[model samples]
Target: MVFELSQSASDALWLETHQQFMPVTSADGLETISKIPPQLGKGYEREVALQPGVELHIFDSTYQDIAIHIPENQHPVQFMVYVSGVADSGDFIYQDANWGYVGGSGIQTPVRTFFPGAQHQVGVIVHVQPHLLAQLFGNSESKLQPTLDVLVPGDEQPQQVFSSPTTGAIRAVVRQIIDCPFSGVTKRLYLQGKVFELMALQLEGISTPVCQNRMLKPETMARVQQAAAILRSHLETPPCQTTLAQRVGVSDRTLRRGFKQLFGTTVLGYLTEQRLALAERLLRDTDLSVTEVVHCCGYSNPGHFAAAFKRRFGITPRQCALGVISAQS
Candidate 1:
């Protein structure tokens, strides 16, 4: 499946191999995935920018037939979020706001595919250059260095894979990026600010106490991922510990251990984080009132929601919503 960089290769011949692909990179940096295809139904368009160490791609479209294959190879550390749409790269799927991944410097990932059908899809892919990786982890060459220590030079596969739902702070900032309502220098400044905010969120995820020496088996990790997915599906009403464990085919003890060892957050801690993240997005993006947002996120009372939102973003829901709107203006 060799997709042309300038245009979409005809799908009939393209899917003969039936292989999915991930974004590829050359020695210099990430190569362009593809430009506008001829049959861009519902009119697909993208806005891209390479601002210093950061690169951004916003794919908003309803093009259903084009086969997207980002050939795999060494690329910079990538953090992608699905603002809307569903993509299938083998077993992994990407969905709005709730998804995030930290791919290491040199790994051969498979071809990634997105299934937008006849509906509109929106997503943002952020690439951080490897040279910036050094600065991101400070000037340290020690084991304390997050990427070097965990992401590693790598062996046959990636040493560390941090893929999970993002926090509300991240969701809020990314929405600002996709909905950025300015152009020229003002727009650039706003974009730069949001990009850095994303960086900070990824940093927090990567900084989770490195259990470099500890390893959880692949099976257990899969269960942990399944558990997280279940939590995502039930954002309005998460399951209890025993129920969640049964659903994922794991004991509560094992589930807790897997989360800490593999995902770097405990079960309830991860759930609370995910809930607050969802609530933050609801408040900032939707017209849901504080009470509705609270109930929708499975919180019984507005008091708890306000406190959690403030704890996570340093502001109440109403304040954050107002602040986000002001920044957008």
Candidate 2:
């Protein structure tokens, strides 16, 4: 149940099984992630160095109840976005559909995380070294102001979790990072750009009214978030407006206003965007055909789906798929 992050993937696995950290070998350097034990449930994990001192971890899992202890190196400031499901870190419970920002130093503090079973959670974790922060801020910490400063005086300075509701802009960029259609140095550049953009969106949202509103009524916003999760869970056939509101224990008006306020989109509109985004992912990552993609995205007519797809992305699904082929070839 204890996991350590040393220098490489193999070292992490060793720490998990042996309860001790070890030197990272060349093979460990080549692989970027610790494989999730089967008993923990099915999942894929990836860790990649997008730049010196910066690593991004993407984990998508459908697991049962579990407790995991993670080592606190106190070295990197961490940022996360829970694409879905709740993340229970013994210190704080970060609910689904939120952006999390943790900046501090570490002090050998044992951190534990819990995840309930049967729910699919997609999360992106970015770890940044202080040196990289200095570089990003023009070699000065003043530019980062309060956000970059460690909360604790010493030790465990890096593990304080600051979480907030995710904005629509931040979610879109995260999807792009997860679904990037590139490899090699190009993929690194792509991911690094999205990471920067994600941070920019987080900064821009700091002063926005939506962020403030989220803080005002946590319970109500959470209900709206429930409606959102419902939509995502049933993207191909989501609940109707009234049914959704009723299910979430909110009035239709509250659901509408809250959805717009919290997510920057109406319920139906958000559903549409989610469908299209999933379509984009399928067309890019899988061998799904254009017609199948359209059907899966909840569109009955290929022509209509094609037109809307082209409008949103400036190219049809076929064209996008073709471009993937051309690039790979």
Candidate 3:
């Protein structure tokens, strides 16, 4: 029998499962004695550990159609590996955002993270810090999009896709992070190196190598990225762009232009988009009501929220929550 989970309550469930699997800290070293119990009809499972500074979560399939709400415009640059059963049906849709197709099919040569927004079901996700990835790439300024709706399946590169050898190397680093036994600052350092190697690979494929000898410009870019990060870090109560600019040491004009150029949206626009994306994900993935979702996304007026949502997505939040949104290709 197939099971379904309520969108509203599943977050608590996710948190509960996360806490249960986390390792207990001791004077000796970081030891993970906890193990996830196998569920009924469980085909495969593994207990993985992330480098200490990074946190990891393994979600069960109680909710077959799981939706994650990433309220920030940027997500941790993550590398994912599928270690088990095939995800027969699912696509990471990039609805208000942009995404591209990455390669992955059953029996494929275990490709590294080459495909942009590659679609899959069963896989491991690695969340690497952007600064770390940038340093590794020698770019000094880098930001990866956080919210990917659903991934398209195809060998052909889709619109807004970012594919390069560097991304693949990041995938390799994820593999190493999963398989290696390094810890402490050493682990972070090695991971940084692996990430750099990944970026280098990406550079190999790019027709225009702008990153070459571009260390001087990264300082300004890094500040722009830092401002965006501040917005994301406070997603619950995200501040205005003016405040964010002051904190990040960039002019409001610079912040606005930089985010638009890099992320395809203005800073405030990106924040709103993030909130709406989070609301949409919760609507589908959780059991939250429209009113509850309103509060969750930081909107006080449900009617205003509904109108804005419809304008951006062509359907009311209610319609989406009812699973009536048309499937995109």
**Which candidate gets the maximum lDDT versus the true structure?**
2
Q: Which candidate gets the maximum TM-score versus the true structure? A: 1
Give per-residue CA lDDT, model 3, range 13-64, as digits (tens).
5456557666444233432333322221222233334453343332222223
Residues forming the 10-long window of minimal summed lDDT in candidate 1: 1-10
Sorted by TM-score, highest first, which candidate order results?
Answer: 1, 2, 3
Estimate candidate 1's RMSD in Å.
10.1
Which regions in candidate 1 have their CA more than 4 angstroms from the true location?
A: 1-45, 65-71, 92-95, 139-144, 152-160, 209-256, 260-329
lDDT of 1 by residue, 163-189 (tens): 546777777877898887876667777
Tens digits of per-residue lDDT, candidate 2, 210-285, equal 3455342434554665577667656777778999899878899888888677668888888887788778877987
In model 1, how large is the Cα lDDT of residue 263? 58
Q: For candidate 1, give the lDDT of residue 135.
A: 68
Per-residue error (Å), model 2, residue 78: 0.4
Clashes of each: 8, 10, 20
Q: So what's the TM-score on candidate 1?
A: 0.53
Error of 3 at 280 (Å): 0.5
